[model samples]
Target chain A: MQLHYGFDELKDIDFMAFIPIILPFFAVGILLVLIALIDLYRHRKTRKSLLMWTFIILFVNTLGPILYFVIGRKDSERL
Target chain B: MNKFIVLIKKEFVQMVRDFKVIWLPIVFIFLGITQPIVTHYLPSILGALGGGQGITIDPSMTAQKGGEVLASTLGSQFDQLGLMILAISMMGIIQTDKANGMLAFILTRPVTVISYIAGKIVSNYLIAAFSVAIGYFASYLYVNYLFTDVPFSHMITALVFYLVWVLFIVSFTTMISTIFNSQGIIALISIVFLIGCRIIVGLSTVIDFVNSASMSKHAMEVLITGSVNSKAIDNALVTLVWIVLILFVTNYWIANKKFNHE
Candidate 1:
């Protein structure tokens, strides 16, 4: 099996070459954060801990949004 | 059949309204790409983070097979964080319906108990399977670009096997949701048991035959070695049987109204 190594020397590696590879990862994360922030903003009246959720979603990265969606969003006043 | 279709449509509508359709796959996609990128860049990341200190990383030491990288995507990323996400997302599959009296209300309709149970499993399973597939495919792309090329046959076959294990996860969580009233308990039990099964996969052969998690190991083996295990077929069958058993328990619990914990 032929293995393609990214670089022979660490210093020789160009960070720009990696931008394409890493871009999707950041894009997905930012999209999630954006969606979460939007949802949290729209439901601010019903959602608990409004300020805290905004901070969590903005700063906590990927997991922050997920946590807010799963636990923070109450969905209904009756429940 | 029409009723089942309606139930499925209703589930899809609910998913869309709840934004589950949007986020679940994205989460899996994030997880899928994370493994390959992290593995490829760990050396540089560590080197840059540390003060050029004690442990220097060798690029040659980081050399890995595309198949190995893909397998770890399933073994490490998908199995741990992926599993938790799935369990958490699905923890309320039936519990929410039960909580809102929707299950009982729906049963009063012309729907059979079988159709009701089937609808829940089918819809949720599709989402779970789709998320995992997208994630696995993302990992495959990165693996091919970053490492050696895994054979087309190996990649496809490994995914088929891995998805069977995912089926078990969905059904098992559904069963727990059906029997338990609290989301926390359901999530806790599903995560613990599923992760436990994954953790004990290679301890013994006797356990391997009945353990649904063996399918995951079989998948990883196919990826790394480019050959299916002799026992993979039998293990898959056992896992299917386990899924059926879980579905049966879920159906039984719902039909008998055993979920009324209040």
Candidate 2:
């Protein structure tokens, strides 16, 4: 049984076809980045190395926001 | 019981405030989809990049069972990166409260130590389980779409076995967080130990019988072969025992006020 068609079919796959499939992936990523940015903006005064975190959150894709949340958010706010 | 509910409520509120409610499942969903998508595309990706010069890629080799792909989603993606993310996100579960004197403050409110520990474990376990389940389901959908369809019974059985391991992870991380002070150390220990258990799963039968990571293996086996290992229940019971021991240590640590190191 041909479990999958060969590379010829794969090569013929439309780039436009992938847009819908991959859109959710991008949406989740962008949502994470946006939430991290908004949180960072709100807590800008409490966090140290504000410029660095802002750069990380904007540039590092998905991991950057998670890093911000896990490490950066706990700077000096706990009282 | 009342205090336990209040504490669980407090934990969820804190999760919402921290954006954990938003990000954790999203991260899991991302990780879940990545395995099947990447596997499905890798041959074409290699063919496109390799210039058709030397090695021709075989499509038959790339053809994989849906169960095998789903199993890899747990073994490859969830075990390594997912474990690390869970550990990091939970590293401060108890450590933060201890550091900020919140543990002590909460204790002073006539709350027994058991309820406090129970609250932490129950709330965090629910979140962890929820995140993992969402991710696993995401992987299941993509696996069925891209590969052969796995049987529904096998999927649920594998998930149940895998969740036993996840329960151990939650309780173990909670214990480490309670006993340790630094988030870095807690994260490091939990990640190393959990990943180590996963790495050593098939080393020996004796070890497999006692290892919680074997539950992951059992899950993968169920997915791939559609047969549950007879020892799966035994391994699960052992894992539950480990969780109970971990929680006992956590309770003992807090009850003894051992966290008041100055």
Candidate 3:
């Protein structure tokens, strides 16, 4: 089922309300990815599976950061 | 009581350190918000994806009701990715302690097996519950803004029933962690079984009584039609009983099973 929405639909959208609702989620997701990437880069030597985790944190959605936080780092049990 | 409370607190602290407390809900909220907005803007999404081809978005989808969006949130988003994160995040609920010799050390203490199991399940369940709540409410807000409001009381009724299933998932994960020795195995067992339950319920009425997935549909029924499903409630009750049975088994296994005690 395909429905078409043109520029007129943009006028109907409540960007004022919608942005607040969606922005943090976008920001958080991006920030987490960046944080995970930075961590992956800094701790490259200490990381158990550097190449895999970098790809994971970089490619996977929100879950990549979580996977890193939960298991990616070496001796992450200390976390 | 104090020791149990302390144990629960420790789990929460671990959750914070693991970044689960910080990220799980944010991720869930993001997922939850997507349901309403996506359903609302499916036309635009299709339009953008169409590229060179002509696309037709369903007219009915464009007017998705609040409850349907909420139901879709639970049915699609949570059932798939949510369960994975839950199982994956909790794979070490018991195995890590067992592997590190922490389980043996804790067992050597005066703490009862019941409390240890309860502490693990309760603390993790609390985070899961809170995360689900944040996600659910975020969806509710967007649905309210974008569609007609579903009855508040009805939504609550549905959630209360739905949370039972969530509790079962967490409790079941903890039990599987005890049975399995590997994180990969625990996640595999938990995900396959829970999702299998959801899928198989469709094939038979007898399975329906034991399948917890029906509870999700039941929860939505209360919101969408304002009618409760008695069979679904019965299934939830059976699920609750199964939860208790699993916990008892986990406790027994934890007490008797030999750990490498590294």
Candidate 4:
């Protein structure tokens, strides 16, 4: 119900509070890596593009995986 | 009918042969797993970065007596499933095929354009459904493991609605893919539509009937909360209309156009 947390409350924070919020992003990040590896394996010849995607996905966080999902996975032919 | 079946079979074969097929299920499963995990952990991660200014969270108090926590958790998962993964996946499928000239080749086959388009739509839908199921189930299992007192029934209901909501997304993206040739363009358009629908729904109080057609409006009211309201029904119908219209246009384009094979 309470979405916002005050800065003063950080001192006595509970671990349970962190579990729900961070878990999804973490899962997404790992999944992105897995998907990238699969793509790399499939398109072995396109190592440069795959590597570029890997970096973009790792550094970009939530939007990174999304970018890869849309623009990154597209074939050279489409470009 | 025979030609349709053959086309479907051909499409399936191609899907299987392509390593990208693995990506389809993997993307969904990954999203499913991450959706809940991210929703649950995001606040804390932000708090950690805030250091001394970080917000304190009371776990026992927050997790204290209620099914609301589970509801929120599932709700967040659905958001990721519907908004991010489904839309992205749909565009990716269509764009990839087109980029590779697979569409051109497939068009030359004996099958009618309608059947070709239908088979592709069906395959993508099935894949999306399976991915969402996996994600929901995984989330449910994790929640059950974490909070023993939480009721499983709520999670089950949430999962059902979540899947139904994602169907709208899958259909919308499929249509977008059919209409748009470029992946970047389609992705941009889909994002705009996704965000635009939400904005329209939010401003519906000022704009009468506009809210009725917004997918987010009904998806949130019906599928997210498990309520079957008229608005939700309207949203579903609107999404269906888009799907039909897009497919018809795509089929017509393919049927009427002549290809030059070099």
lDDT of 1 by residue, B1-262 (tens): 9999999999999888878888888988999999899998886766655645535565454787899999999999999989998998888888888889888899889899889888989999899899999988998898888888889899999999999999999999999988888889999999999999999999999999999999999999999899899999999999999988987888888888787766
Cα displacement (Å) at residue B13, model 4: 4.0
TM-score of chain A of 2: 0.79
In model 3, the runs with Cα more than 4 Å from the true position are A1-3, A6-21, A34-46, A49-55, B51-54, B258-262
True lDDT of residue B22, candidate 3:
69
Among these predictions, the greatest DockQ belongs to 2
Candidate 2 per-residue lDDT over residues B1-262, each given as its tens digit? 9999999999999899888888888888888988888888777676656554434556554778899999999999889889998998899899999999999999999999999989998998898889999999999998888799999999999999999999999999999999999889999999999999999999999998999999999999999999999999999999999988987888889999999997
Per-candidate interface DockQ score: 0.35, 0.38, 0.35, 0.26
Residue range with the least summed lDDT across 10 consecutive positions in model 1 chain B: B51-60
- Report clashes for each candidate as comma-separated counts: 0, 0, 5, 15
Per-residue lDDT value at B138 in model 1: 91
lDDT of 3 by residue, B1-262 (tens): 7779989999998777556786778667877887887787667656656653556656778877788878888888887788788888888899888877788898888999889999999999999888888888888888898798988987788888778888989999998888778888889999999888766756878878777777877887787787887786688888888888999899888877544533
Model 1 interface RMSD over true interface Cα atoms: 5.2
Show model 4 residue runs off by greater than 4 Å. A1-35, A47-50, A54-70, A76-79, B17-21, B33-82, B92-105, B147-164, B205-227, B258-262
- In order, the candidates keep a fraction of the true contacts of 0.28, 0.24, 0.24, 0.28
Pairs in steric clash, model 1: none
For residues A1-79, what per-residue lDDT tens digits would candidate 3 score against the true structure?
4355555554566778768766766887887787678766776766777888888888887778877865676264643
Which ranges in model 1 have alpha carbons more than 4 Å from their true place? Answer: A1-12, A74-79, B53-61
Q: Compute the lDDT of residue A63 as modeled in candidate 3.
A: 78
Question: Model 1 misses residue B23 by how many Å?
Answer: 0.7
Runs in model 2 lying further than 4 Å from the true structure: A1-11, B58-61
Q: Which of candidates 1 and 4 is the stronger one according to TM-score?
A: 1
